[model samples]
Target chain A: MHDGILTIDLDAIVANWRQLAARVAPSVCAAVVKANAYGLGMVPVSQALWRAGCANFFVATTDEGLLLREALPQARIVVLGGVRPGREQGFVEAGLWPSLFSLDAIERWLVATAASGTSAPCVINLNSGMTRLGMSPQELQRFIESADAERLDVKIFMSHLACADEPGHPLNQQQLTQYSQLVPAVKARWPEVVLSFANSSGIFLGQEFHFDLARPGAAMYGVNPTPALPNPMRPVVSLRLPVIQYRTITEPSWVGYSATVQVQAGQRLAVVLGGYADGLLRRLSNRGEGELAGHRVPIIGRVSMDATIFDVSAIPEAQLPPIGEAWVDMLSPVLDVNLVAEHMNTIGYEVLTNLGSRYHRNYVGGAS
Target chain B: MHDGILTIDLDAIVANWRQLAARVAPSVCAAVVKANAYGLGMVPVSQALWRAGCANFFVATTDEGLLLREALPQARIVVLGGVRPGREQGFVEAGLWPSLFSLDAIERWLVATAASGTSAPCVINLNSGMTRLGMSPQELQRFIESADAERLDVKIFMSHLACADEPGHPLNQQQLTQYSQLVPAVKARWPEVVLSFANSSGIFLGQEFHFDLARPGAAMYGVNPTPALPNPMRPVVSLRLPVIQYRTITEPSWVGYSATVQVQAGQRLAVVLGGYADGLLRRLSNRGEGELAGHRVPIIGRVSMDATIFDVSAIPEAQLPPIGEAWVDMLSPVLDVNLVAEHMNTIGYEVLTNLGSRYHRNYVGGAS
Candidate 1:
């Protein structure tokens, strides 16, 4: 009786992680459970992954790190958004490691460590070429030469890939080359420091990206890390929205908000209880498709806030789902997130992360 | 300490509702608090409206209707998505009214009423020119003639306008004309039954469209009901994201995932702790603008799941807030949800409904 049912295959997520782990064998594979595991519920997904052998977890903010700590007390949690000023003690008190992006942040961590009287091992994020976060190679060189860098217990030296999804992009090689140059200096300072260089897509880029530790987020949640090739991971989520209203077009008329589209007299329509507010993505109106009674149906008009109308005339009259009993499958193994992303003109990560909280979440398969 | 702060001015919402209520003077103004009051926290918004003389409230689902019933015990709560078959008892037990789209749904409500041995009132949804839901005019006439119609309490006869946002759309007049003819017949059956004909945008379509109860959702939350005219409602929400990493581009560099955009040397950039996952649409990459210290900054690249990069070189170094203290304003009175929606190629409803739950929610003034 919920708006829709969001079925998450925990086994599929675990299998995906295991497959990536096997691909990056010998290198420690860390799980990136940030953004609520890309909007699939962080606690449950991380617990499933933790039980499956994953020990290290990466999240976006300090709050998420604290939440993951509460969920899996023994798992190594790293906050990629780093420590906010004045909130540093909470990180040290919770035993959650913060990823330091700048020297100023590194200095703040040192201050927190001194105040808390705790040895907080932190990750150093390097800006290889993303130009989004972290210190540049030159900054890395300058920091390593400074005496303050020696006082900190640096656990991981990590950098992100800007174009890892596109293997042919020259920036991939350039970023790899730039980050590789700083490895020796960092290793010289801290021989025991783990080097993490690859993300989900980066793993598919090659062993050159495997490094010592790799953290993959999108791929573990069933996104296609290798977009150029067929998806190797099992589909991790399936969504089915309940049809609340079923109607037959009595005349030639417009449908949905703004009367964006039309239907003929013989057409049949089903209004589902989920819409853009439920993460159907308003841009998907009149573009997306749904599976109803094993028949393909086209969305007819602008998606409303709480309902989406689909033209279900393709199905035989006998197979039409009665109003309260039938449900429309929006996402399944055949219609995965990548396909939905394509229709929404965005990436799979955006599609997954944008999934709303109005659904009845059901988890299955985590035995492995 | 937080990723960002989302300030919701509850007073503006109440003011907007009152303004709309005055616009349709003598007609009861029902507040549509569906989709978590368009993602502004339903309970608070509904309670504020309830205290300000609003008695009728409409929600999208049975769950929401139940929640609203619990929040404002004395207020009339109507479930627009209607009652599921087996879940009908919950609605009758809770005294939650449902919008019945079909005669079949009406029969189910009757069954729930008989089983509970309590009288239940429901709304009859008319298709009016929108083929998305409800019975056709011919079916409505037939239902009114049925014996079952005399046994139930029909409190409101509601029909949604598909083109009310567009004043010039022919469908508005057509829908109005069709619904107007049913008024006499429906009144003969239930003289006390209220007629709800307008949503947020429909209220602007003139008084002829406003019947007994006018339900406004978006306009009450600061979405411009009249799309072609200047927004008259006060802005209700403002969002600011913390800058976790601020750096000056030292060389020509690409930014964010896939390396879609480049930045010149000497450019300053700030990576904020909110991205697509946090309701910053991914399409806003290289297109959206944010304000930092009152200076406008353009977004630099693709919004990641947890971060977005803004080129903040326009701000003078002396005026720049230190790394953790700086926060970029994504939404404000000037940069309201409508403007953000324009950049996202969507609507304000989509913008408001898509706001994620990760930020610190601060609710301000609700004083009448």
Candidate 2:
């Protein structure tokens, strides 16, 4: 196996989910399994989460919702992207709830429900401050005032937090205030409507933010919810790349593409079989570090398409194993995902999601 | 489909390969189909290239070489990563050529060959300038002097270019000089040894760089080969993402996570169903632009896992299609791969290889 090994700890994922669930007790914690459960394989992550007592799941599209429905038959799978006009039957038949973002989508779902002669439970996504998705305040008000609200089976009234990651951001308070105001108005018409406003970061804000359900995606996948504070979540993935070859330069030499790094004479360099194509970002060329035994080795030069060279001169001679027999940990408990993200000038979410399919993925410690 | 549509023009790929092949005529133009053909699906891309009369294929690892061998039984598949000790049987059985980069690998292959009583052809990779992989100058000299050189079935003497993209880089000339020197030395012992050098950019460096074979990967995938000159290759990929939702904010509001972009009252935003997880880098949060009905729209705020909000205020309201019916061209003739790379502060190769699997891939116009 020349490909890197991506070991995913499902047990750690479950523990993280449980921790988040415990944080917001009495409020249901829904797992966001969109983007293939943040590129950690949706089926396995969702199964593990479901086993940890997660009853509600959120996916980006109806297609993902369908896949999740097949994986978790009893869990309530909600498509956050909502229903397309012609493709409503898939969501309806599969018992997948579409988070209707606009009045047009609401009307389309209503028509589909009427055609099927069966009303499907759905969430009404209200836009508080984030202008990306959901219905505007005017549109929401109009929907609540109209008789269309009476015809639809609305189970949840949800709104996404724009600046939830930042606890002190004014937009969070603004969104929270708008959502708090809208929930009562929604409940006035539909008293049984469940309110779900908090996300991963929002759950850390306060108990007031946690209403009926808390949706956490990144935290469960081992991404730091609180950027300013230390991460409370356990590490879930460790990437181990094999050393394809090692070379010693007796003269001054350049390494990798663009001739970026210059190596001193008699310096040992190990070429690992993992690069940008394996989701090791090109930005991590000279910045990234890998762990060999207990010592850290700095990655030298530009990251190639399928290889990255690391300066292993700091390690003792006896510690260095033969090329194929040795491996370097790109991501581990010590070299955490957050640090990798920092090195790449991005977030942990990008690091985890960009992890390519070339790795030999091993999902360890699920229900078994 | 809610997922983004990835349209791969195989005819364009063939045209690009033909162009590269034409550039290095009389010399073998092998296709580097490693990293799953730079994340464009290896099987389809290799098949298309094979149909275009590409007889030689280069892959990163033995596993990839095996897969390519299965795809094109008669084609010469060279594993650039070489054999991993005990895994030599698979390569020998599959008739895959392993490019030995080190003396350790050479010794292992010799043992595997002697045990099996089969002398499989292999390539000796020499380190001319880039010390990332292959045998160093000293190691190559020692190997040539050793008695083991007489027993090996070495077919090709290859060296990779370090700064081939930069035509005027001193390292290019240095590498060429070193490789030129090594070629004659290798041919002195083994008169039948074939010399292979020159990548996609190296083909443009001059005819001198193109020895016996030119291995091009990125240019065939529509990445700019000669950065200083106009690209001779045709565009092979176009990505179109659906508009999941659209909203007109009537108040001062934030868009996407982190409240990165503050929108003025009555600003229109379209949430497209593609984000960082879909290989759209998070660095492109507020910098990236997409085309909607020939109008360029700037992406506002942070790019989420499954969605990106595009500021579509410039686009005429009459031209805007219904929410789900509308689509934006993320990568097209106008929004080329190189342009996206610039937006993400990376190279076109990184952009192409980082392309995720969630997109509904459509391959069009192959050899009929």
Cα-based lDDT for every prediction = 0.90, 0.88
Query: What global local distance difference test value does model 2 have?
Result: 0.88
Per-prediction DockQ: 0.86, 0.80
**Top of the candidates by lDDT:** 1
Report the C-alpha displacement of residue B25, candidate 2, in angstroms: 0.7
iRMS for model 1? Answer: 1.1
DockQ score of the complex predicted as candidate 1: 0.86
* lDDT by residue for model 1 (B1-368), tens: 56789999999999999999999988989999999999999999998998899999999988898888888989888899998878988887788889988888888888889788887699988988877777778888988988888877999999999888899999999999999999888888888899999998998889998999999999998999998999989999999999888888877888898888888989988889999999999889989999999899999899887899998898998899987678999999889989999999899999999999898999998866
lDDT, candidate 2, A1-368, per-residue tens: 55689999999999999999999998889999898998899999999888888899999877788888888889988889888767899988899999988888888899998989998579999888877788877788889999888898899999999888889898888898888888778999888888999989999999999999999999998999999999999999999999888776688888889988798988988888889998999998999999986789999999888899999999877889876679999999999999999999988999999998888999899893
Error of 1 at A365 (Å): 2.1
Candidate 1 local lDDT, residue A281:
93
Instruction: Tell me the tens digit of each residue's lDDT in model 2 across B125-206.
Output: 9989988778877788889889999888888889999899899999999999998888877988778887899999999999
Off by over 4 Å in 1: none
lDDT of 1 by residue, A1-368 (tens): 56689999999999999999999999989999999999999999999999999999999988899989999999989999998998888888788889998888888889889888888689999988888888878888999999988888889999999888899999889889988999999999989999999999999999998899999999999899999999988899999999988887767888888777878888888899999998999989999998898887888898888899998888888988676679999999878999999988889898898888888899998866
